[model samples]
Target chain A: GIQVEQSPPDLILQEGANSTLRCNFSDSVNNLQWFHQNPWGQLINLFYIPSGTKQNGRLSATTVATERYSLLYISSSQTTDSGVYFCAALEGSNYKLTFGKGTLLTVNP
Target chain B: SAVISQKPSRDICQRGTSLTIQCQVDSQVTMMFWYRQQPGQSLTLIATANQGSEATYESGFVIDKFPISRPNLTFSTLTVSNMSPEDSSIYLCSVRTGRGNTIYFGEGSWLTVV
Candidate 1:
């Protein structure tokens, strides 16, 4: 089984600030995804990046498959962005998506 | 994008009881997965449910404890048997559509065992 590690277990930011979250996997992965779990307990898909980079509004993610790492960037953060950010990697051998413990982000208004 | 709907968004159950959670996908999906999120913990994959086949349970998870049924491509059910307070967690259902391998999740069923 592959192991996933997320950095900076916690983060604090003010509205309009920018922050970057990182995820590192122990083995090769067939897929990588980022999710935002709102206070209400809904896991919202952020990005599905097996490789390369993708952007959605103020949020963007980049996955370097060869390096076994992924980064999620949030620009102009908002109070709505305050939640747990998770990075999951789908292992190629077992095809199981393993999740990181998550980074708890707090954006103060 | 697929629309996933789960029944009994939240519930409270007594110890030694069982509860079945239902997962319904708006479109036909190739793979469905059940995950458990313990309080203040990350999500852990319980099993992968494929249509017409027995689900593949992950390590630390067993078929007897969390039995899954995949009757068709669009629906599935996960039953947590003989649950205890340790089983109190948020059970989530996720699906992978054939479109591009992107996975989407339902609202999740929050269960509290007392």
Candidate 2:
């Protein structure tokens, strides 16, 4: 029902660099999450932020529900951070996540 | 937080044969979700399984291709029927504790069809 779009389809960063990823949804959402898909293909939840800002180590996320968009920030990136970062949302109570295409980040050492 | 275990962490299947993937949750949950992640892609919602009720699948996915069964609150199974190379991807199961958004996933089942 809702559409999710992610910006910067691909990114290349040097070790210790910083970058920002954005996700914009077409409809209102109550549950929004940032996930990191590692090389092994495990979807690791980074933050469950429907609104406001949250920081976890070097990764941080901010969601502006009113604007229907969210931003993910990765500071001082490491090679281990190389993978695809995805943003998903829950439009209704069912809470089933509708995911964005994702932002692929490659950090070269 | 919930700990999830998926049977046969990885498998190799021959085309035209079907395979079942099992998802087990340590604690009972009201909502269980099935997802597929293709190579170099993001997660795609396959369906949402609720205990004692039928699963609601996404638009492109069909019941005939991916049949899901949630007989109980803590267990569910997804069967890929008449598998092909296109079905070769990573299938994952996740659960929500009912607070709404916090969804956790298992390690995932890697399927390779030859």
How well does each candidate superpose onto the true structure, as a TM-score? Answer: 0.97, 0.95
- What is candidate 1's lDDT per residue for A23-89, written digit by digit as tens? 9999888889999999989999999999999999999999998899999999999999999999999
- For residues B1-114, could you state the per-residue lDDT of candidate 2 as single tens digits? 888999878999999999999999999987899999876667888998768888898889999999999999899999999999999999999999765569999889999999
User: For candidate 1, lDDT tens digit of each residue in B1-114?
Assistant: 999999889999999999999999999988899999999999999999978989999889999999999999999999999999999999999998878757899999999999
Instruction: In model 2, state the lDDT of residue A46.
Output: 97
Error of 2 at B60 (Å): 2.7
- Model 1 segments more than 4 A misplaced: none
* Model 2 chain B poorest ten-residue lDDT run: B97-106
Give me the displacement of residue B78 in model 1, in angstroms. 0.6
Any residue pairs clashing in model 1, and if so which? Answer: none
